[model samples]
Target: MSVTIDITGLPQERIAFGPSPLAELGAALHALSEPGHHARLHGWTTTTAAGLKPELADRLHEADFMWRSTRSDILLPAQPRETLAEELDDLDRMDDERYVAAALEINCAGFYDRSGPSPLVDAAMRQRALDLAAARGPRQAAFVRRMLADPPGTRAWIRRLLEDCDEAFFADTWRRVHVQLATDARHKTELMRRKGLSGAVAAVSSALTLEEDAHGSRLVVDKLSDGRTTAQGSGVTFLPTAFGWPHLIALYAPGWQPVIQYPVSSGELAGVLPVETVKLRLEAVSHPLRMRLCRNLARASYTTSELADAYGITAPEVSRHLAVLKKAGLLSTRRRGRYVMHQLDVAAVARIGSDFLEAVLR
Candidate 1:
């Protein structure tokens, strides 16, 4: 049901927190390419996209798989890597075996074990990698073939693309965001000190929860795929980023310490959300009935008719509340058959506090 990290015997200090410049850079590139999805960063993404060189833009498209969905651990370090320069150097100097394994694991799911040791790239392992890549399609197959033929060359190409991205826009973006990230990490560290591990882990994201049973304590993370990995005494690292909003990344790959990169609680850009925007959000949920609707929708999506029936109100009345929420961008709706189902935008609603602060200060 969830990805969990066993923390029964894990010590407090072993659980660490920090900012990862490489991860932030990767997320920023991903945001630039997919601007529609990350509406929150529209202003920054637009500016960054205009400045990107044609060649760098083409390469980002060419190796789109690197940052899409589950980002390749090759691009994202599995620990708290401090500086972009240092991380890039380490990635450039990575050995062939590890490079191939990490890159192949991106497209070839289940090619390696998370709990087991990192497999050596023997002849059989190479064959399996190729076969899995072939099943994924020509593009993936070609990438894997190139990796197999020359690991160093392939890694170099990937590194250069990242370096180009840094030169183009990410360096400036990093300078602006690193302070916010460091501040957030410190805030979470304080939460850990005051509330212990569970409180801090819960604060990272709404999707993560700390639980315990006969088997021992584990930090459960909501993810599309389900798997469990133990701390193994190495503990886990938590990294906060401004670009990776509405999504949380957890890496439990073999041969590296587990790391979870979460979005900052506050809006990415300070003083970006206007006062009018904050006013609209507050007015959307100000009504008692609308507030109730939001609470219910947060738990689960419901149709207008379903909500009306549950509340003993008319469908038209429910529709009015849904309309207000939708107008303020507080809800998302989809048509399921004849009924329109409405769900609250949890991330957008959660940003009210931060947005309010920015608006007030501005």
Candidate 2:
């Protein structure tokens, strides 16, 4: 199954590039909560997760679904503003009907009864939403019910969540990664100019390809879902994000601009420290916590949270240790449900000595 976006008449000037702090913030939340999905972000996720306040942590837990799938415009606005504050204000200033409708659509997990009257006004649609939410879980069902009952209150709660997330971690994170995102955007823009849209698309991800036929040009994204959306008047917006690595988020929600948020290219980050990479791997296992983690992982795979509990350490601390080991190329990961399961790369660890010698000799 795949999603094809028809960009038949998409103008050259319509091809845009920029960084969205609000979008990145949403991606960060998704990465933090679903650590197993973004192995490349192990270091940043752990450090940020450790610093979150208790209240913020609880709120994030409850609202995990909103950010996880990137399905809703409320979380990731189709058109990003220059700053997060501006983006939040845009959301705040949105008309009540539009705001509530979007929230309701997301709360129901994309279950919309379009066959009925206008959204939020149709009784059948509300019932449909409630029915779908019920199947997901109790928490999700409750949230949908509350959204139907009091939309303004729910909107306020969502606003507070975004603010809290920013103050807790995203604000600082933006400052650190925004420059890199901008650099990536420039690189992509050049690629599009030099090699055309297909080249830029390929640079973003292998899962994305451009196809042309009698129907016109379409950007086909390799996704689990099957659907097609024609480019609306707003054209396509390409967003680069630092925290959204190892996965691409393509938003094709109706009544909104089509968006593709991809991980910033890391090719430019190739450092001159080939030997240092090997040293990092060796030094990573030398740490007492990491050594134990390596040994335990050698026996069985474990999530960051599970390892933290077993070692009587904070999750952030375990994450920090795990990040080092992963960077050293001594760790590997896979996803099991919502959690990232970690395992030791025994062969990589064994090759460290030989790798060091080869690098030094060369």
Candidate 3:
């Protein structure tokens, strides 16, 4: 429901603010996956739409499409880069081990499972695997199956997929709007300089549902579920975004810095949506995909990633679609271990359908 991040006694220098290429890469991928975001970023996406792998291109166009793997701490940098170029360079220099760690860390797609021998088999990594086991999807499973079968040669594919995504989707937008991001970072830095950490936070608090009192700052991101993470001296890094609007993402990696990313226009990120909500039934089944998904779930329940895989889309796409439908009262969802499952409200669907028919008949 909300995440309260503890930043007690965190030095001002520890809290750095800047734009990150890695963060934007995730946002750009998000833009491609979500229809609303696609609408906002149409100019950039259309240019590179042709270069993406055929299936990926089609998936991207699908209103329900989503990319799940990018939501990892390994993909984000612990330190702030002075410029987007520097951030990109930092991203490009990461070795395979780091990529593999991230891949294994959030293997909701089952890539590491069906493949050959894995370092993840180790006890420490094994626990991580169990934690993420519930979120695996067919597409990621298939990708891993293919990679393990091909091996050595296909290893490059992982990095290439990420690099291509960043180059195609985020590069142009970054170059065009990076100055604005710098301005944002400067504004926040100046706030901390003029006032204190609390002052800077208080200033930004006006833009978000964030609260700062005796217990540090609690950024109310309803999608985050009810959890709290201490700043731990890593200093909070605020990433201002353009396309990844409406969704507030709070990321904490036990040894890495805790990062809070919000849309540049975060007027009310929390005190609201939680990834699942209730709405006025009629508005729920309005969209074709939402209705289709509702019907699909009418027969059974499926996790967000599973639904995405079945529909040949991405997790975020399905997540966003489901969020609206849930809010509109068309569906209900639950979390089982790491997997979040959704079910169609059959009675409500029937009621709404009959209501529509009766109105038309009259």
Ranking by lDDT: 1, 2, 3
Clash tally, candidates in order: 0, 0, 8
Task: For model 3, give the 10-residue run with minimal summed lDDT.
Answer: 353-362
For model 1, residues 175-233, the per-residue Cα lDDT tens digits are 88899999989989999999998889878877788897898888888754456777876
Best by lDDT: 1
Q: In model 2, what lDDT does residue 255 have?
A: 61
Provide the lowest-lDDT 10-residue window in model 2: 353-362
lDDT of 2 by residue, 1-362 (tens): 56677899889678788888888888888778766445557798888889888888987776665665343566666677779989988898887666666665544432332222334677866786675455445676687778678777887898899988888788888999999998988898999999999889889877789998897899887753455776847788888888765456676766666778877743211224478775777688676566666644543356676677556789999999988888877789887556577876644654554322111111
- Of the two candidates 2 and 3, the one with more favorable lDDT, higher being better, is 2
Per-residue CA lDDT of candidate 3, range 1-362, in tens? 35566666676687777777667766777555433223445566565554677865644332111233235554456675755456656655665444444545444333321223343334544443443343444444454444334544444554455565556555666777678877887888898899866566665544335566775655454431334677765667887666555445666544446777756653211123333432466566666677556544653457886677656889999999988877777678787656677876644454454433111111
Every model's TM-score:
0.68, 0.68, 0.60
Q: Which scores greater on TM-score, model 1 or model 3?
A: 1
Q: Candidate 1's error at 149, in angstroms?
A: 0.6
Over 4 Å off, model 2 = 69-71, 104-119, 135-138, 265-362
Q: Which stretches of candidate 3 lie over 4 Å from their true place?
A: 37-39, 42-70, 82-101, 104-119, 122-137, 145-155, 166-169, 202-224, 266-301, 304-362
Q: Which stretches of model 1 miss by more than 4 angstroms?
A: 112-141, 266-362
lDDT of every predicted structure (CA atoms): 0.71, 0.69, 0.55
